[model samples]
Target: MARASRVAALAIAVLFLCGCGTVANLETGYRQGWKNAVIYGGVRRDVQSAGQWIDHSWTWGKDLDIIQDIGTVVGVGLVGIDIPLSAVGDTLTLPVTVPIAIYNNSTNRASVSRKTDAAPPAAAVPVNEK
Candidate 1:
């Protein structure tokens, strides 16, 4: 019985350390945090700087991305002891997902190049023909 319980506890801990908490936090509260920062917090230089640091320019998407990433790190750190691994995986997913989210979430929904979009767009006309 004692060994069985210990195994169960270890399993739980491993699950917690797999970044589930970070992904949950991201899915649940990110939009609210973003709205609060942009709407209530307003434009502060510090906020803008953090925004630029994450996404390379001070658009709202970038600003909210900083908040999102920080929350992911802190949330996963609190819940997961193996934060280095979890943070690494979470960080990787964001840059790829976030840019696509920004592009798709826009009113225009225009197509944009993504880091993993790998395929180069076809030329309007073949170079040999031109």
Candidate 2:
């Protein structure tokens, strides 16, 4: 009976240790995944904003206007811009600083710009070669 009890105790201890390790691993993976989602989502939003700015600038000209919307996601903050006016030559310029939470895996913050002169100089050149 004593031998059987000892074996049972050892088995219980081993099971407890294995369960603890599994929990730790699961927690670590969850944290990493959450961090990645925040960083990637921020980057994706920035890219979309840049594309929209380009298309709007092209269609609207210089009369572009943008309204910023700020919110948080899973403790990470995000900023969104809504451009209502898209008319070139209107001379609309605004400077905005947006707060974003970058994941621990990332070494730098995301930067987004909405401006009139983002196009390359080569693209602005006339079709007729000088």
Candidate 3:
């Protein structure tokens, strides 16, 4: 009975080690999300600044980003892919995300420019005014 208990304990230990390794991938996904927040923020600004004449091209890029994020989360957190696969996925998806990030950034920049252009100039104060 003692031997059986020892064997069972060993089996449990081995299984725990194997299974828990994948759980770390959840952290990997979260870290990626935090790292990409700037890109997401630009996308948000694009959404907020969209003009009636603008066709909202950022929507497509935003959808792509969301799809990629969901895929990464599911792949790493739910499917329990290896930790290294997280890096592999990031590498593979860079090409996909980079353009979207750039597009979003440019959109935000243009929006800022338009706001600046539309702003009323400051009133000039008379030098002799008290």
Candidate 4:
């Protein structure tokens, strides 16, 4: 009876450890995926806005390569489980939230600047100000 109890306890412990490992892996993957998506979205918005800054005759093909490279780097990092996460119950959450917030801010700023530049100068300003 003693030996049987010890074996059962060891099995339960191993199962618990395995469960924790699985949760950790899932959480890390999810966070990394989210980060990659946010970064890529920001990069795309920035590239599009940059396109408007250049003359109509100029192309943005070369500039787009940089965005693609950023995406690749993010992809590699995610697949490698480079992003860490904290366990909360059964779910894993990102340990760092700053990157996502910064990316969102950058995207918003780029989009706003692009729209402002695209609008006619007179339309962008109030008639009373002029």
lDDT of 2 by residue, 90-129 (tens): 1111011111133342334323333345774565656886
- lDDT by residue for model 3 (1-130), tens: 9999999998666444433222233334347752343322322322333331132322455347655555445444423433333334334445555675676678779888887756678889867856
Model 4 off-target regions past 4 Å?
Answer: 1-96, 118-130
Q: Write model 1 residue lDDT over 68-129, tens digit each, in one string.
A: 66755554444344344445444545654465445446623443434346777787885675
Clash count, one per candidate: 0, 10, 0, 0
Q: Please write out the lDDT profile of model 4 over residues 13-116, one tens digit for every residue.
A: 65454333234444454678643433223223333433443424243576676666555555444333322211221222233334555775788798888877
> For candidate 3, what is the TM-score?
0.29
Output the worst ten-in-a-row residue range by lDDT, candidate 1: 35-44
Off by over 4 Å in 1: 1-17, 29-82, 108-130
lDDT of each: 0.46, 0.34, 0.46, 0.45
Candidate 4 global CA lDDT score: 0.45
Top TM-score hit: 3
Off by over 4 Å in 3: 1-83, 117-130
Overlapping backbone residue pairs in candidate 1 total 0
